[model samples]
Target: MRITKIRATPVAVPYRTDETWAFGSRSGMVSVLVELDTDEGIVGLGEAAAYPSAEIVLSVLKSVERLVVGADPFRIEQLIQRIDVVGTWHHVKATSPAIAAVEAACWDIVGKACGQPLVNLFGGRFRDSVEFFYYVAAPDPDTVKAEGTRATAAGFTTCYLKVGSDSLDIDIERVAALRDGIGPHMNIRIDANEAWTAGTALRAVRAMLPYGLELVEQPVSGRNLQQLAYVRGRMDVPMLANEACWTRYDQLSVIHNGAADVLSVDNQMDGGLLNLKRSAGLCAAAGMTVLKHSLGELGVALAAATHVIAATPNFRHANQAYGALLSDDIVDGFGGGVDNYRDGCLDVPTGPGIGVALDPDRVARYARLYREHGDTEFSFQHPRALTTGLALPKH
Candidate 1:
C-alpha cells in the first residue's frame, strides 16, 4: 500500500536514576516515534537513535517525511535509494542516523503485513537463543566484583564492566577482583568509553592481561583508526570497535587497518538491522567478530538484534541486558522473553515484528511527560533526542 501520511512525534522518558559513563551523565531519554500511515489503514511504528530531542527529531523528520509522503511504503529498498540520492544530491552526511528510523519502521510494516516474523523474511533462524553479556555499571572494585559474581551466578556467561573513570591501576584491580570473584570460566569485557590515550590503553591492557579480558572496547578513541590499529597491534587482548565503526565506511576502515578483533555494531548507530547486516557481511569477509552494542533501547531493538545475530554466524556474543535491567518496561510481559537468569543465554522470541506489543499506557505516559514538562528535566528539546540519551539543554 502507498504511504499516505508520515508523522513524527517526540517523547521524553525519564531515567529512574541518573546514568553516568566516561563520556557524560544523562537524566532521561529523548525519542521520536514515527508513524507511517498507508492507504490500506495499516500503521507502522519505528524509533530513531542519536536524537537529542529537538535536533535529531527535526533532522530525521525533515529527511524522511518529504521523500516518503506519497510513495509505496512496501518498497523499502527503493525508499532507501531515494534517500541516498537526495542526500547525495544535497551533499548531506549526517542523515544516516535519522534514516535508520525510517528503514526500521518500514521493516516493521512489512512484517506486520505478511503476518510473519521479520527474521523469517530475511532468513530463517539459526539459534533459538542468544548468549548475552551483562554491562556492569558499578564504579568500585568491590562493587564490580559483587556485580560480576552476581551476573555470573545469575546465568550470564559474560559481563562488561565500564572503566576509564578510575586510574589504570584501579581499573586493573577492579577487573582482577571481578575475575577472582567469578573465577576462570566467565568472560570479562571492559569498556573505556574512549577515555584513554594510546599510551594509557597500552599500559591498561598490559596490566589487565592477567585477568583474561575478552576484549577492551573503545579504549583509546575511535577518531583515529591509525592510532587504534597501533594499540591493537601491541596488545595481546582483542579490541572491540564501538564508536569507531558507525557506518559501512568506518567499518571498512576498521577492517582495512586491522584495528579490532571484535566490532560492536550498534543497531541504532549503525543504521538499524539492514545496515547492520551490511556491516556484518563486511566483518565476516574480514574474519572479524560482530557483537551488538547496547544503546538502552527497549525490547523492540533487542528483538531486532536477535534476528540479525541469528542471521550472522560469526557474532561472538550479544550485549542485550537492558530488557532485564529496566525497572518497568512496556513490552516485558507481552512476549515469552526471559528476564530472569537462564544458564547464561537468552532465548530469542520466535514471533513476528520484534515479537512484543508496546503498552499503550506507557506510550501515553511518556507523551504526557513531554507535553507537560517539555523535556526540561531531561535536557531534551524533542522526542527523538530522548531516545539517544543525549540529554540536551532545554530552551
Candidate 2:
C-alpha cells in the first residue's frame, strides 16, 4: 500500500542519571518518533535518535517528505534509494537517523501486511531474546561502584562504562572501583569514544589491565586504521571499532586492516534495519563479532533493533542499551528500565511488525516535555561544556 501521510514527533525522555561521556553529557534521550500512515489504513512506527540535534532530524524529515510520501511501503529498498540518490542524502551521515526512521516504519508496515514479525522476515529466530549491557554512567569512583553493584544485583552479566576522562588516573580508579563492586564474575566493558592518542591509549589500557576489561572501545580515533591496528596489536584485550565503522564501507576497511576484533554497528547511523543485518553478515564473513551501538534510544528504536539482533547470529556478546539510565519510556511494556530486562536480556516481541505499541498518554507527556525543555535539559551540548576548550587525545 502507498504511504498517505508521515507524522514526526520529537520527544525527550528523562534519564535516571546524566549520561557523561568523554566529550560532553546529556541529561536524557531526545528522539524523533515517526509514524507512517498507509492507504490500506495501516500505520507503522519508527524512532530516530536525535544524533546531532532534534532540529536537524526534523529538517531531514521535512526535506524527505516529498520522496517518502506517495511511495510504496513494501518497496523499502527502492524508496530508500530515491531518498539517498534523488534527495541527495547519501553523503550526509547526519541525515541517516531520519532516513533510517522512515525505512524502519516501512519495514513495520510490511511486517503487518504479511502477518509476520520482523525477526521472521529478516531470517527467523536465531535467538529468542537479545542480551544488552547495563550502562554505568561515569561519575565519581564511589558512584561508579554503586552503579556496578546495582547492575550486578539486577542479574546483568555485562556492564559498560565510559572512560577517557580528563585524567587517566581517575579513569583507572573508576575501573578499579567498578571491578570491586561487580566482583570477579561479571564483565566490564569500557568505551573511550576516540578520546585518546595511540600512546595514551596504550598507557591507559595497560594501567587498567588489572581490573580485567571485556573490550576496549575506540581507544584512538576512527580515522586512522593503522593507528587502531597498532593499538590492537599491542594490547591483549580485544578492541571494538565504533567511530571507525559507522557504515558498511567503513566496516570493510576495518576488516581489511584488522583494526578490531569486534565492530559496533548502528542502523540509526547507517540507514535502516536491513543495513544493520547486512552489517552483521559482513562482519560474520570476516569472522568478527558485532554489537549494536546506541545514540540513546527509547522503546520504539530499541524494539526495532532487537528484532534484527535476535534473528542474527554472531551477536554473541551483550549489545548496548539505555535500560539502566532511562527513567521512563513512551512505549507501554518494553525497554524502559532495568525492570523490563531478565538477566540483561529482552525477549523479542512476538506481535506482528516491531510489536511494541506506543502509550498515547506517555507519548504526549514526553512530547510536551520535549517542547518545554528539549533545548536545554535534553541537549547533548551542555552549556558549561561549550565554554571549555576540548583538546582531543586527552594527553
The lDDT for every candidate, in the order shown, is 0.69, 0.92
Q: Weakest 10 consecutive residues, lDDT, candidate 1? A: 386-395
Candidate 2, residue 371: the lDDT equals 99
TM-score of each: 0.86, 0.98
In candidate 1, position 120 carries an lDDT of 77
What is the clash count for each candidate, in the order shown? 18, 0
- Cα lDDT tens digits for candidate 2, 24-53: 787888999999999999999999998888
Query: Model 1, which residues run further than 4 Å from truth?
Result: 9-18, 50-54, 88-95, 333-341, 370-395
Give the lDDT of residue 247 in candidate 2.
92
Q: Give candidate 2's whole-model lDDT.
A: 0.92
Candidate 1 lDDT, 1-395, residue by residue in tens: 87887776655566544445565545555555666788887677676543444465566677567788888877887887887776552243344546666777777778888887777766767766677776666657787787777776677778777777656777888898899778898888888878888888888888888889888898877988999999999999888998898677788999988889888776676556787888888898998888787665554556666776776677777564553334354455421223543765656666656565666787778667767764555442333333543432110
- Residue 291 in candidate 1, Cα distance off native in Å: 1.1
Largest lDDT belongs to which candidate? 2
- Which pairs of residues collide in model 2? none
